[model samples]
Target: MPESFHKPVRRPSSMFDTIFGGHDPADTARVAHSTAHALLSRVREDPEAEVVERLVAFTAEHGIDTIASLWSQAPARSLPGALWRIYLLQLMVHEDANTSSIIYERGRHELASADPIVAGAPTPAGPDEMVALADAILRGVFDGDFAVALNRAASFSRVEASGATHLADDYELTEPERSTALTTKALRLSTFAADLDAAAAHWRAGTLT
Candidate 1:
C-alpha cells in the first residue's frame, strides 16, 4: 500500500445519511478504507497497465452501480472519497454525453483550441464516445500523470460551460440571468482545474486528501 494510504486518516460521517438513513457510516468507512487501500496498492505495483486493468475488471465483475453506492456516501477526504469524486465527474459527463456533445459543438467554434494536456484526444460525439474518453482519462490517472487528466477534465468543463453560455444567449430573447449563471459555471470549473493542479502536487508529495 502507498505510505499515504497507510497513514492515520480521519474518518468522517457519511454525507448520504439523511437520505439513506439505514446504512451505518462506521461499517461503510471500514469497508471503504480496506477497499480503497487494496485498489491503491494494486495500482502502485504497475500503474500504467495494472491500474486500468484492475479497475476495469473490478467494475465489470462487481458493477459500477454497486461501487457508486458506497462511493456516494464516502467521506470527502478519504481515499475512497477522492476516488468517488473522480468517478462521479466522469459518470456525469458520460451519462449525458450526447447532450454535452451538442452543446460542445455549438461553443467550441468560438473558443481557442484546447491544449494537448487539456483535450488532447478527439472530442466525443455521443454517450458511448464520451464514456470511452472518460475511461481513458481516468485510466490516465494511474497510467500517466494524474494532473494532466484533471486538467483535461477541467478543460472539458470549461468547454461545456462556454456552450451553456452561448445556448443561453443564442435566442433573440436572451436571458441575462441565465447567461450569468453559465459564466459562473465556467469560472467555477476554472477554479476546479487549478484545484486539480494542487491535488496533483499533493499526490506527488504523498499528501493528497
Candidate 2:
C-alpha cells in the first residue's frame, strides 16, 4: 500500500486574507478604487442628490478600514490619497455636522459686519447644508479642478477658523475655551487643505516629484 500522506495546507497570503477571506493589498486597492469611483459616480449623477448620508453609511460599513489602512501610506497625489481625502471629507461632515454648523454659524455672524465669505463656497447654515456643501466640494474634487476644490475648502475652513477665534475672544460664555481649541483644529485643517491645493497645482505642472 502507498504510504498515507496528507497534502500540505496552503497558508493565507496576508492577515487580511486570513481574516476576511483571500484578498491581497492589490485586491484591496482595486476594491477601494472601484468602490469609491462607483459611489462617487452615483452621487454625481443624481441631479437632486441627497446621498451624503448613504455614502457615509456605505463607506463605514464596507470600505473605511481597508482604504484607510492603505491610505495612510499613499503618496499625496495618488489615487489612494484622493480616496482617503474623499472619505475623510465625508466622514468629517457626517460625524461632526453639528460642530461644523456651529462653526459656520458663529463664523458667519462674526464675519457679517465685514462681508466675509468664501468666494465660491456655499454658506452652510446647518448640518444638512454642511453635508450638502461637503458633498458638492467632494464632487468638484472628482469632477472638476482638484486644486480649486481644495482652495475653496481651505477658504471655507479659514473663514470658519477666524470666526471660531473671534467667538472665543468676543464671548464670555460657558466653555469659552472650546471655540479656541476648535479654532486651532480648523486652522490646522486649513493649512492641510492649502497644502493639498499646492500639491494638486504641482501635479498639474508635472513638477511634483
Candidate 3:
C-alpha cells in the first residue's frame, strides 16, 4: 500500500448536511458541476503538458476524497460523474498496482474481444504498465478526447471484469471466500463498464452534463 493511502484525509460532508441547514442541496450540486467543468476547461485550454500531469497527480498528492466530495454525488452519466469515476479508477490502480496488474493480465488472456486493444495497455500489462495505462487514460480526458477516454475505460473495465469472473471460477472449489470476493469485484467492474460506456455516449451527444 502507498503511504498516501494510509494518510488520514478529511472527507467533506455530504448533501445530507442539508438536513441540518448546513448546505443547500441545489447549491452544492451547482458548485460541483461548475467546478468540474471549470477544472476541465482550464486544463484543456492551457495546452501545457506539465499542467495536465499536475492534474493527473492531484488526487495522489492531495487525496481522492477532495474530488470525491465534489463529484461523487453526480449522476453516473454526467460529466462530473465521469470525471469522478476516472479519478477513482486511477486511485485504485495506484493503491494496488500489483493486484490490478494480475487481474488485468488474467483479463487480457481470457477476454476474446478487442477490448485489450481498445484499452491500449501494453502486452503482459505488469504493475508498471497498469499504472501507466491508468495515467494515460486520465491524461486523455484532459488533453486528448474525453469520449475516447471513457470508451477506453469502459473496455478496460469489461476486460478486468471478465478476468475476475474467470479467476473466481478457478478459486470456487478451494477458496470459497476469495471466489465470492472476486465474483463481487467482477459484478462491480461490469457495472462500471456499463456506466462509463453510457457516459461516453452522453458526452458524444453533448448531454453528459
Candidate 1 stretches greater than 4 Å from native: 1-34, 47-54, 57-64, 74-78, 110-117, 123-129, 171-195
Can you write out model 3's per-residue Cα lDDT over 144-173, one digit (the tens) per residue?
988999999999888889988999999999
TM-scores for all predictions: 0.61, 0.58, 0.88
For model 3, where is the 10-residue window of minimal lDDT? Answer: 13-22
State which candidate, 1 or 2, has the greater lDDT.
Answer: 1
Per-candidate Cα lDDT values, in order, are: 0.57, 0.55, 0.83
| Model 1 TM-score, all chains together | 0.61
Q: Is candidate 2 or candidate 3 better by TM-score?
A: 3
Question: For residues 1-209, could you state the per-residue lDDT of candidate 2 as single tens digits?
Answer: 11111333232232111233224766765665566556546665662434544443444355445555545334445444554655565556555677767876777766653323542435556777777666666656555565666555655555566566766665536666775565565565555455566656765786533
Q: Candidate 2: minimum summed lDDT over ten consecutive residues — where?
A: 9-18
Alpha carbon RMSD to native, model 2: 13.6
Alpha-carbon lDDT of model 2: 0.55
Ranked by TM-score, top first: 3, 1, 2
